[model samples]
Target: MPGPVSNDQFFARVGELLEENKKAGHGSVFFTQKRLTPSNVQNAEDKDPLWDVNLPGPFAVLIRATNGKSKENRDDKIKVSTVVQPESSEEFFKQYADVCKAGMQALKPKDRSKRKKKKAKKRKGPVDGEKKP
Candidate 1:
């Protein structure tokens, strides 16, 4: 079995995945965390280069560039991951909330598109009680 990957290597893969998303015309990506398990063993050199090494932490985060609902999309999905180890459960939750908030803010459009122009209403004449010039 391969050893766990270094933190630097994991983060580097993250950058590469982000770039891949941009090149593939993906506008957004999803970040998710998963607990490492025997069923999901990914530390094989044959499966994924970045995942060749076993991760240290119990939880691993995977950032997916494409939604995997469709078969083709699933095949084309690009994800990078890293292990996370916090000092305490409370710390983990706090940091998770902060990260989610930041991600939400980043996903929001910087400048909302202007509202569609309203059609001008046709005017037949002056007010019913007012005299026309």
Candidate 2:
């Protein structure tokens, strides 16, 4: 997919999230310009050369769940990505909004304990394993 043309358009989508009703869940909608390399430049530049070359803009949306169903489980999140194109921007947004709303319902609170890394147990005596009382 392509991406939203202007910040206004992009923000318009973001604004929808403020209502706690976008990004396919209780999270945020992120816009990331598509990756560009020397080879891909040719096609991307076709639309706007200077823009594609210098600006290198956002062409996709990242929908991630933030804090839903519980406050402590903020880490539990659902991520959904979509592309934006001139032809499908509106449709994509509509689909994303619906997705956010639908997915949010089934979102399970993250288990904070699982996310925590287990610290290694300290050596009882010494690193060389020397016997000591």
TM-score, prediction 1: 0.34
Candidate 1: C-alpha lDDT:
0.48
lDDT (10s digit) by residue, model 2, range 13-64: 4444444543444444343444324445456555676655464554444333
Put down candidate 1 lDDT per residue, 11-79, tens digits, no spaces.
454445555555666555565655545556555767678773556654543322223335665665555
Error of 1 at 56 (Å): 19
| lDDT top scorer | 1
Q: Which parts of model 1 have CA positions greater than 4 angstroms off?
A: 1-5, 34-70, 87-133
TM-score of every model versus the real structure: 0.34, 0.26
Runs in model 2 with CA error above 4 Å? 1-38, 42-82, 106-133
